[model samples]
Target: MNSSLLLSLAITGGLVLAAIVAYNTWTLRRNEPKKAQPPDPSAPSAPSAFGAAGMDPLLDPILRQEPSLDGDLAGSAGASPLEGLDRGQDPHDHAIDPSDALRMPAPAHMAERRPGLDPLIDVIATLTMEGVVSGDAALAAFPPTRRAGSKPFAIEGLNDATLTWETPAPGQRYRSFQAGVQLANRMGALNEIEFSEFVMKTQAFADAINAAPDFPDMLQEVARARELDQFAGDHDAQLLFVLRARQAAWSPGYLLQNAARVGFVAGSMPGRLVLPASTPGMPPVLTLGYDTQAALADDPEQSAIRDISLSLDVPQVHRSEQAFARLRDVGAALAQAMDGVLCDQNGQPLPAMAMDPIAADLELLYDQLDARDLSAGSVLARRLFS
Candidate 1:
């Protein structure tokens, strides 16, 4: 054999072996079971933040951030930097955060469980928008609108509510503020479900505006009462509460005053709720009591007692009507306070030039409030049948 030809034959044999090996490898890969690719891992991870993973409408945004049911309800609202109701405090104890609104519903039974506010506020705000909160005076402004039929005096703040506890004894008068809900003449105390729901939801709202703390108008001055003192009969008390829910973030005077008078004000936070000074022996005379209970349409009960009447100094109605006037004017201020606040529902500012519209709306409010034809239901107030 020639040496060159032999060398070529060896090389050819090597090539044939390599080809066989490659062919076998290809056959194995084709016959091997095909892999079933897993579904995208991201698809199953959303619901904890929004709706249940597969059911969320807001899931897209919720999945993008950590979600807390409580915090979400709150932050879902307005420009109130104050909205984190449970931030520093334990949600179970109902230990109110001084930084928020005093509107927690009755105390909770167990810390482990919680209710939601969305339903309650939705109902109330809708009712209010429908003129329930506006009262009859508001209704007269648009005569076409009528009362929401008389239901039981629910929501304690409505008419037909009562505080019918028998008097304690001499030198003492017993008063109570029990809220009710009414759809017509058939009114009754608020049910547990409704009341708690309102509180839970309202807390979200209060939290929204908790910190901004709208102050009284620079023009209006309310002589806030000093703390309750057992031995302090001559201690001074304020004349009136300016509507500050719109601007002043201070605790609502109605809540504070009621709390202080009883010495055991019931509420969510201790710091925010101050009870009145009343000891067993040195009791402060229940000189005045504001009836927050609802009464029959014909039954007259005064909603607020004139502080002037209670005050040692000028014990006569201020007669200025300015306080009442504020009801109409303050609506604009309240609307303005919400200026930068997005719709919370839509994350956008209110209707165009929102501030100007608020003022104009308030002006229209004054006309409606003072309207003679609708005055009967204007303030939704009643004077107790003395």
Candidate 2:
């Protein structure tokens, strides 16, 4: 054989062997089943911050941040810096979560649960004397005359106190206390004068009964009261509209249900409806009901109905227009519901045109108060009014 022919044959044989090996490897891989890759042990697992309900609404915003781009947060730090901090914190810690701050503690007075008294007693001045007296006595037995707007007062016996005692059977024997008065509670200054008169009148009663009486210096209290009253009158002067049942009387149950529909809750007094107070012990901005009696009786099932009145504490609200408008609307609804007529202090019926002037006046008054930096129904207003 020639040398070149032999070399070509050897090369051809080598190429055939290589092709056979490649074919065999392909067939083996095709026949075998594919196996899944095991999870990487090096990757960290994410901790779930919520239950089956999924992410909390408050946390959704924070979690929505995308960390993919440039390996940086999408925005500034979100949520509280101490979102996942342990709740058992030190008492002196300054860092309070916003959500936790929302939950306010109850007031000291409410925690003590002081017994409630007749709201009339709170609003009115009261004078009491313990001795043998009659419950059925007339107002003539008292000094101050009963009038309207300017000077109004009431006289009743201490029969209510006798009933307060735990021991029974002592109807009028040992509990022979007499003479209680409900003086007007409009303002501190006016009440000062009313209270002084009350003190003097009680002195006369003591003289008549040959009894010694304890009295304080009237001049100082009166002066202080006058100052307080002046501050209140300048800031807390209120405008109100009265609604009375025109033909038939309004039931207490009906009144409460209707008032509640308009967002008026049970007030401090029986016959009163009030919006939420600005702060604890502060008077509500809006109040409604009758003057002489409570809005509702202690026992609604066995109580008689009387005339209903609605009033608004103007200074107690930030927006006088909104407050006045809401009151007017609510009053109109109540009047219509109870088959009553809206009126002024007198029996004269109120027209729709009447509210316009009142609204304007409220705006002016609100501006005045705001200018003086003593917004009505604010902490300052409440302090002065108080």
Candidate 3:
């Protein structure tokens, strides 16, 4: 061949080889699993579910970069950076001056003013009294067991002084009374038998107080209970993420040590730890649990723990807390620290793709709950879900 023709052939071969290499690289990339990027600690969090209500943003938990397990674990694994910072005077230890106490206005009324009976979730019974009754009298007339079968039974009084409904308490006078039985709970919808039992309890209380008891139509209430129960069952979400050890099984102490670095504290129960809610007295944001047997063993350090679970009870936590987001962040952090992988209850690896759909679904569920005036983390939603 001529030199020019040979050169032309070599150029064509080179072009074809370059095209093949590019195609292979594209194929490899396309087939590789997509990794989820860890959330940027400095970035503003997603808008809260309660943002529409203009709730205080300060209520949200402070965000910090999750520490890597590769660091010195023994030095300060779980300690907060703000630990040494001055927090002003301790409220408990500070003595209140008598003049300051006198200057403080008395509360307008007792804080427990809201009535116990929520018609939306309870089957209510109105009790009309001929005259005012003492709270002591009402309390005496209360049912022996504060339950109608599996449902909670409660009685509230219209305070003669405050004109607000409240649970009957001594030294107060009530112009009228109301009783309620929960319509449904996790146990199931209220049935005719439970309704009958509720009526019996309310009627007896009314007789003892010499009041006229008016109960709702049993059939209609039962139907409403079933519908409410169905909605709750469909919307309820209790998410759980399992973390499996990648290689060597972790001891209970090892798991606790790593989990603590991510803000987990010992729970009330054995083999359990919790990420407490930002608000005091609210249910915990997340629960971390492992083998109870391992926790209870005399030598817990020797116990081999292959897997642990992180759980979030949706309705119990306010959406403003960004609990689900925290669950993901904490799970990722712990997985990195403990050399573990996040999985589902069935031990299947949980990928970012799988979780994205869940987040979307949760938003929809929150909307549905809000539409029904049972927004997640509200008193009504908590009661209904329970």
Give the number of the best model, judged by lDDT. Answer: 3
Stretches off by above 4 angstroms in model 1 are 1-345, 350-352, 372-386
Global lDDT of each candidate? 0.24, 0.44, 0.69
For candidate 2, write residues 1-386 as lDDT tens digits: 58888999999989999999999988755433222233345755322211122322212324222112110001111122211111122211222222222222322211111222222222232334455444324222445454322333333333454454221123432232233223212323445556666566655654554344554455654555455444334444344456766654545655555555455555444455554432445455466655324333465523335455555545445563366766677778778766678766445678887677656655655655555444655544433333
TM-score order of candidates, top first: 3, 2, 1
Between prediction 1 and prediction 3, the one with superior TM-score is 3
**Candidate 3 residue lDDT tens string, 272-375:** 77776766666777778788898899977667788887777676667777877888888888788777899876678888777776666566656666667777
Q: Model 3 — TM-score against the truth?
A: 0.71
Q: How accurate is candidate 3 locally (lDDT)?
A: 0.69
Candidate 2 regions with alpha-carbon error over 4 angstroms = 1-235, 277-282, 291-302
Q: What is the lDDT of residue 175 in candidate 3?
A: 97
Off by over 4 Å in 3: 1-115
Which 10 residues in a row give candidate 1 its minimum summed lDDT?
Answer: 308-317
